[model samples]
Target: MPAPRVSVRTRIFELEMVLAGAQPPVRRRVQVPGEIDLAVLHEVVQSAMGWTNSHLHEFEIAGRRYGIPDPDWPSQDVVDETKGKLFRLVEQGDRFGYVYDFGDNWTHEITVEKITGAEPGVRYPRCVSGEGACPPEDVGGIWGYEEFQAVMADPAHPDHDERLEWARGSFDPHRFDLDETDRALQWLAWRPLAPVS
Candidate 1:
């Protein structure tokens, strides 16, 4: 008998995620295993984009919401994200939305760019490229981020010194390191999670 053929569902998926309304368009290009769950995908995104994961998040695909459903809000109708597989739920060219921090409303547009077989000896999920630093957590929304940029860039601005102090002297809005993000991912494709209640 022949060796079991590699299934397409076991391949790799290249995705591009862009933070909506960022000035220069903060974006990340990542290659993730198709079999990984959306819950793990959330981790990969957080690591790749330099987010601290300090607030609630949700994914909306094909008009359905996925996340850790809240018992207190039973009407939200969110499916458990941990149960959704990437390959099974999406295909090349599909687009979805991810919302983080309901108050700040940091939204990301995620596109499935390509799907191909996994490479031997290579990590399953890694950041291939990216641009722009994530705005500080609770930097407000895009408008607030714009305001932050203005104040941070103008030392003469009244809030400049205080903003600098908050950012620990300086924050580079355009800084993005592929190696740093890749290193942070480790083997996220196989990461384990406790059962969602």
Candidate 2:
């Protein structure tokens, strides 16, 4: 059978001054109803940083960082990777970054084959901007497997039809299958870091 459809939604919530002495004070939140599209997430982050695909820079996700190389600051892997792709330098700081292959067919949706440190169940509603300051939240119990599957099946679901079509037309079941989904869950299931590493 073909892989089930995956529905993902992006919603932004605005926060105002609810009370005084609040540490965060005010903030806007983005919520995804289901699994997040890391590629789309990456695009949102880059846009917030005032960068575009044409511009190159090193960035970090999870705990790892990668980007275009500079003579002053260099990463051998990044330099080698960007040989043909033009990129600009990105300053060091706390941020989330992601990289994925969309495959040869341009119509294919990019599958998040690798994620830096974003684990399943880890909440990153505020991290939508890629700033590292947003502490991860616990989303483990927010939705169950049955709920997720239902969302995928619902035609009214925001990403249901689109993600399903993408999967049917672009995804290679043999290469990207149920195992990949399980991996994503495994990552999300990890708890936030404690005081010590």
Candidate 3:
């Protein structure tokens, strides 16, 4: 199939993805091309949220499960994520769940805030706005993350030095770099686009 272009008729999905149960709310507002595949959308979410994509992930929308097939589970009911297109499955104001890392169970709530025509001279799947640093991978689930933060905050704690080393130096729970996140998604600009003439 030919790559879809962003034109007058081709809309964009403005999505807000929030890390479920995050204390300060790690969230991102992004614009994704209407025709992209869900598999690529997974990449977008990973980039915008600063996840390393080091673990398994899946999407649950409207009672349907979608993910890559696991060879270990032949009867797995997941529909191939690559076979699903973003625009085909969602409309404005729709909400869905995305869980990354089965163990940590980092649950994210994704909502389609609006659908609008694409703008000229702009990239698709751009991170427009966001806040809060993504929790370190393998830090455990919400409860583990909470404890990790506490440990990192108290230098006197016995585990502080070890945790800091694991985090690779000073860890700022509130640090989130918008430009950095946008830079990570810059490769998505390669998506074919042709303005309506």
Candidate 4:
């Protein structure tokens, strides 16, 4: 007998990150290995949400905060996200919170929708579907996003031209390409580096 053929289990989560009052929330349906730690989940979230991974982030569940604790700054109130496993913290239908960029307070509400077995040949962590584009990083959170949208929509706004120019390559607040997201996931999962001599 071939070691009883163990099967890999996966968890599917429906993550929604919304700027309160902002029209059309950003949502992602993601699947990950059940045993993966929260740190990996953080990466999954970043990949799924079109985030640049340039800011600090934290996960809050059951009243505890999880993130990469700065050893130099011990006062930071967070446990290592690497130490917490998703299966240990939540089950199907559980909801938690994630906050990225503490200064801007970009918060996301995460819900565990289903627990299922991994499909053969499919990537462990990938975004199956999503809606809306993520807000630009360093845009001062929800309020700033809303204001930025307003300004961008009205070319006559005082700072419209400057903001548009600044946001040149990433000003599309309405675009969400599944292929782009899947490509990002593939790249993040397996990127080639220079081979060792």
Candidate 5:
């Protein structure tokens, strides 16, 4: 018999969370297509959060990526819903900030900011969990967040001056206006939610 075809669908949902320093609350949601395979979906999220396939599955969202598994997260269902919503929010903006699974319940919260430059000044620093560099070691590339920050902070370090200069350069905060907010909401308001089979 022929194999049964797998069905996939994408849905958007609005997510609201109370951030550390913000009053009221932070609200935003993005539409993400659902995947037939939970493993694949997990991989995509892990990649976005700077984890490679080799890393052990730990309920921690630190080390380069902001949203990993945390101890204080809500139930699994709520966490999944929050993650899906946050993904869409990040995809929509030029730059965004997220704090996931911070407190009990592993709630993932994100803030999408507006990008001003012609080019999106966003950087996805991949985590180096001892993965063999794709290219041979000869070629140099950008370092991960920890390494980069360390180098930039240490004035005595060789790359500190250059890294510091790069960090100091002026950049616009990617904040959305009322119209963009409405658009994001509309997108999520109409999205369909279904459990992954």
Candidate 6:
């Protein structure tokens, strides 16, 4: 008998999450398995981009909203994100939107660059490359980020010292380490969630 083909289809997704309205474009490239759920996708993004994942997030694609549906807001159109698989809902060349921190309105433009099979012995959901540092949480969005940058650049500015202190000395808006990001992602992908007793 011929060897049966294993149906494990690993997806090599070159997903780029670009912060909306960010000049020079803060972005990251990640590869995740196609069978991953939107919940896992969210975790991968958070890990890859250095986000703390401290706020609500939602994914919008093809006019459908996917997120943890709120029972309090019964009329909202969000579906449970944990139920959908990436390969079933998306494909290469498709574009989508991910909104994190609704108050700050941190919008990310997510793009699917490529889709391919998984490699043997290689871990899934890893950050391949990226550029630019993520904005601090609750920094008041793009305009605020620009103001923060200005303050950081000019020591003579009246609020320079205060802003510097606020930012914890210096802030590099262009630093990215793929290895570090992948390391952080270990908690998100490699380990299984602890089952409830």
- Model 2: per-residue Cα lDDT over 66-152, one tens digit each: 444557656454433223211122212223333322121111111222223333433333223111111111111113223434555
Give TM-scores for every candidate, taking all chains together and pairing residue i with residue i. 0.90, 0.22, 0.93, 0.85, 0.26, 0.89
Candidate 4 residue lDDT tens string, 54-169: 99999999999999999998887889999999889988888899888889888888888888765555565667787788888898888989898889889899999988887983
Candidate 2 stretches with Cα past 4 Å from truth are: 1-28, 32-38, 47-53, 66-75, 78-197
Q: What is the lDDT of candidate 1?
A: 0.86
Better of 2 and 4 by TM-score: 4
Judge candidate 5 at residue 21 and give its lDDT. 31
lDDT of 3: 0.88
Q: Which predicted model would earn the best TM-score?
A: 3
Worst 10 residues of 2 by lDDT: 130-139
Q: Residue pairs in steric clash, candidate 6?
A: 10-118
Q: Score each candidate by Cα lDDT.
A: 0.86, 0.29, 0.88, 0.75, 0.30, 0.81
Report the candidate with higher lDDT, 1 versus 5. Answer: 1
Residue-level error in angstroms, candidate 5, position 78: 17
Error at 165, model 2, angstroms: 45
Model 3, 27-77: lDDT tens digits are 999999878888998999999999998998999989999999887896988
Model 1 per-residue lDDT tens digits across residues 56-149: 9999999999999999999989999999999889999999999999999999999999988766546658789999988998899899999999
lDDT per residue (tens digit) for residues 1-197 in model 6: 43112234445677878889976568888887777789989988888888899999999989999999999997998999999888898899999999998988889999999987656555667788888888877788888888888888898999999988888988888877778888987765542223335
For model 1, give the 10-residue run with minimal summed lDDT: 1-10
Ranking according to lDDT, highest score first: 3, 1, 6, 4, 5, 2
The local lDDT score (0 to 100) that residue 141 gets in candidate 2 is 17
Q: Give the winner by lDDT.
A: 3
Query: Could you tell which candidate, 1 or 2, scores higher by lDDT?
Result: 1
In angstroms, how far off is 195's CA in candidate 6? Answer: 29
Superposed model 1: Cα runs more than 4 Å off: 1-9, 187-197
Clashes of each: 0, 9, 0, 0, 16, 1
Model 3: residues with Cα > 4 Å off, grouped in runs: 1-4, 191-197
